[model samples]
Target: MMDHTDQTTVLTHAGVMAMLAAAIAEAEATGQPQCIVIVDGSGELLGEVRMTGAKYLSRKSARSKARTAASIGAPTTAIPDAVRAPIGAATGGEMTALPGGLPIKVGGVLLRGIGVGSGSGDQDVAVGLAALRAIRAATEF
Candidate 1:
């Protein structure tokens, strides 16, 4: 029998929406059209939004970035190109080495990942980080 003793914490739908709102607000503040994606720990998409005037390709890129971060349990930017290139190829380009992807965690337990695209890497990262901060501010975990 498999032991099921370990407990896992996941983000609620409300939490995901809160993050999205914050990300969108950040993008608006900077006058940046952006695409944002949120994924659960299993790399399943939880929520997504593409702001007005965002590039068409940004939707897919944001999803890929979120999935990559969730799969690796780290920020996508932290993955070296040496490691990311092959993985990107192996995954049929479902992964991205973008800097806007961040893993969402609480007390060492990963909850999800948030990714932003259609802006400069720095701007995307700022939006993603803002989302994480919003979640932290709204919830205890």
Candidate 2:
């Protein structure tokens, strides 16, 4: 159902970096300082940035955002925590049911990742989406 080349295209550090930068810029423009995180397919940090005035707890929230996206391989907001119960229980609390995290995908395969926080959940998700959109617009992979 999936191909190895597709997987490779989606997980590159460059791709992840681009997405994170775009997300951070978008968040900064909103006047609500935020923290942005990018992780690899395995949930390892690829990139991270915190904007001015971002709250202290935003760092942890950003991590949770990335974890949620990486675990589910989708936008974190797309799958709320209520729907993550069974999966979270099985994963031993690794999965999250929150906003501001997103998985980078290419050709339907997950590559790098995204996470945003320090503002409202909706703002966080919005910033993450802006990053994804930039990625999608920049290149096919």
Candidate 3:
């Protein structure tokens, strides 16, 4: 291995905007204004949105969900139920067990994470999926 690491792929500003746009559209289509958050694989925030009528506190939860997905490379729901509370407490609630968070994987490379809130879990998941589909068309790892 080299002494230093090689450069890694990152989502561009345009890409993040595309994902956010898609997520917002999905939320509107479902008639649930939502708070959506996206994070890079390193758990750095990229983009976010709080649509009209969305729950104020849901933004925090959405960020937690995005960070959770980025940290774990899986949906927030993947956290084992037995350890969910412990993990949340350990992380100071930085991670979540809700169903809205999903990893943005393309051709097996985890690139980003998205979380949507202020709606039912299913609706949130739907919004996240829409975001993923945006980048899916542009890149596959």
lDDT of 3 at 125: 96
- The total of clashing pairs for model 2 equals 2
**Mind giving the per-residue lDDT tens digits that candidate 2 earns over 20-120?**
67787787788888888888778888778888799977877787778778777777667754667776677675666667787777776666667888898
Work out the TM-score per prediction: 0.91, 0.77, 0.91
Q: Which window of 10 residues has the lowest lDDT sum in candidate 2?
A: 3-12
Residue 129 lDDT (model 2): 85
- List candidate 1 segments past 4 Å from native: 1-3, 137-141
Clash number for model 3?
0
TM-score of 3: 0.91
Give the winner by lDDT: 1 or 2: 1
Task: Give stretches of model 2 more than 4 Å off.
Answer: 1-7, 10-13, 80-94, 138-141
Question: Residue pairs in steric clash, candidate 1?
Answer: none
Q: In candidate 1, what are the lDDT values of residues 37-116, reduced to their tens digit?
A: 99988888899999999997998889988988888888888888688789888888788898898888877877788889
